[model samples]
Target: MCKNMKELQTVSERIFSLEQKKAQKKKEMDELEKEIKMLKNETSSYMKKRQKNELNIAGFTILFTAFARSSFDKDAFIAGESNGAELYRKYSKEIPMERVTVKVAK
Candidate 1:
């Protein structure tokens, strides 16, 4: 028990100190949450930019392939004694593919 006024003052001071500490900690947590939110926004923006770029690249690849096929003889292009022919022969084999799609909610 706090027997004297000095002891009572000490207890009050301790409670005030603890409350200040708690407020400081709460402020720090709020700041950290704000930083995390900003980072998530930046990351989401970058991911959207990357997806757009990938779609553009896929479109260009399809257009280029169609143009090449129309402009050149397919058999000659694939079987010619050229570096491109060798690359096509080396890397053109089909492989099974799987992809996962992510949809963001509005």
Candidate 2:
């Protein structure tokens, strides 16, 4: 038990100080959580943009290759180089390709 008025006042002041500190810490934690959410949203937006750009590039490359094959002579196109040997375009063959796509829920 606090004997004097001064001792009771000191104890009350300490309790008030601790409450203030706890509130301050809670506020800081909320701000940090808000920042993290904002950053995650920004990251998702950037990833979508990057995926769109990559698909555009791939489409352009395929179109360019097809256009080149149709417009130019087969002898002029270099097909592949292996072991210091240069190979020219001879024929076209269809190869199976696997593609994966990601869809986001609204």
Q: Which ten residues in a row have the lowest lDDT in candidate 2?
A: 61-70
TM-score of 1: 0.46
lDDT of 1 by residue, 6-100 (tens): 99999999999999999999999999989866765554455455553222232232111111122333554555456875656555544432222
lDDT (Cα, tens digit) per residue for candidate 2, span 3-60: 9999999999999999999999999999998986676555445545555322333233
The local distance difference test score of each candidate is 0.55, 0.52
Q: Residue 101 of candidate 1: its Cα lDDT?
A: 28
RMSD per prediction, one decimal?
A: 18.8, 19.3
Q: Name the best candidate (by lDDT).
A: 1
lDDT of 1: 0.55
TM-score to true structure, per model: 0.46, 0.43
